[model samples]
Target: MQYSQKVLDHFMHPHNVGKLENPDAEATEGSPACGDQVSIFMKVDENTHKIQDVKFLSYGCASNIATASIITDMAKGKTIEEAKKITWKEAAEELDGLPPVKMHCSVLAVDTLRKAIKDYEIKHGLAEEDKFSTDKIIEELKKVIYPNVGEDIVSLKMVKYVGFKDGTAIVDVEIPKFDKYRDNVAEEIREHLEKFKEIKDIKITM
Candidate 1:
């Protein structure tokens, strides 16, 4: 896969790549088992609500490191509200574009940053924790990209159904039997939904 020069530069020498000793907010996302994970730390100015400093630690491929590096750069000096507006597509565009298969790295990076900002908001009583519902599950599904096209499965109309009850969540996705990303989509669904404490078991059908 061909990577843009910017991606290569950030991958080779990532900026703000470290932990903050006394971070006001922090968050970790992704799973090592899936081969990608990121942790974001932030020092915020209470009065200004600005991100005084931001840093990240990434474990994955070049795209992962590059996305994390650029994301922290985008977040630093921005207010928590401004940083919350950062989107994965913008992050990818900032890196001059990432391959379809590697686009999820940008999504993961943005998700971690948003989580960190949420942590700060909750800590400072700026926001309240959201209640978990099937809608939340659907929202998470929107984050699972269809690698073949670099679009979310939800928007692709690949998700046929979603239901949650008791401690189990059931998802029915529409992926061809011969599709190479079938298993990947299922795994992505599991990974995203498993984070909810309300969900004890996941059932995915394709």
Candidate 2:
């Protein structure tokens, strides 16, 4: 596939290429089911809760690698809270929009960052109250009104795993392959996480 100028620039002399000497958080994520993997490292200032540096090493296709690199570039210097709100659509827009099939690569990149942030929060022992921002999402699910699925996502066990790092939200959903509800499930999770300005990233696993 021919990549756009922006994607080419990022893929070819990517910014923030190396690892931090002493990173505040490090995370690895992938799908053996899909043969894609990415690892991200971040340096954070405790006092300001801001990112000092960000870098990633990924074993995947060009789009995935480029997306990961782009995320690091955009996230550096932003407060953890600010960074969490950076959306996949923004990344795609920055890259001049990837192909439909390659869209998953971009999603994976965002998901990787969210996982890394969760790692950071765990290292610092961030409070439980700050994490599990599940109430609003649960409420949103109530409005969906699934026929057989029940009133809320929480009651349906639709949200398999919930976690946070810095302000990023890590959500995992193990939906059955070829299910019609997969996309809807993922979107609800994303919308829920986007509520928090601190949640820069949200990851959905199936």
Top-lDDT candidate index = 1
Report the lDDT tens digits of candidate 2 across residue range 47-129.
98899989888788888778988998888899877887876667778899776556656666776787677778778876332
Measured against the true structure, the TM-scores of the candidates, in listed sequence, are 0.98, 0.62
- Lowest lDDT sum, 10 consecutive residues, model 2, at 142-151
lDDT of 2: 0.70
Provide the lDDT at 145 for model 1: 96
Top-TM-score structure, candidate number: 1
Screening candidate 1 with a backbone cut-off below 3 angstroms (N, C-alpha, C), the clashing residue pairs are none
Instruction: Report the C-alpha lDDT of model 1 over 112-136, residue by residue, as the tens digit.
Output: 9999999999999999998999999
User: Could you list the CA RMSD of all candidates, in the order they appear?
Assistant: 0.7, 9.8
Q: Model 1: number of clashes?
A: 0
State residue 24's C-alpha deviation in candidate 1, in Å: 0.3
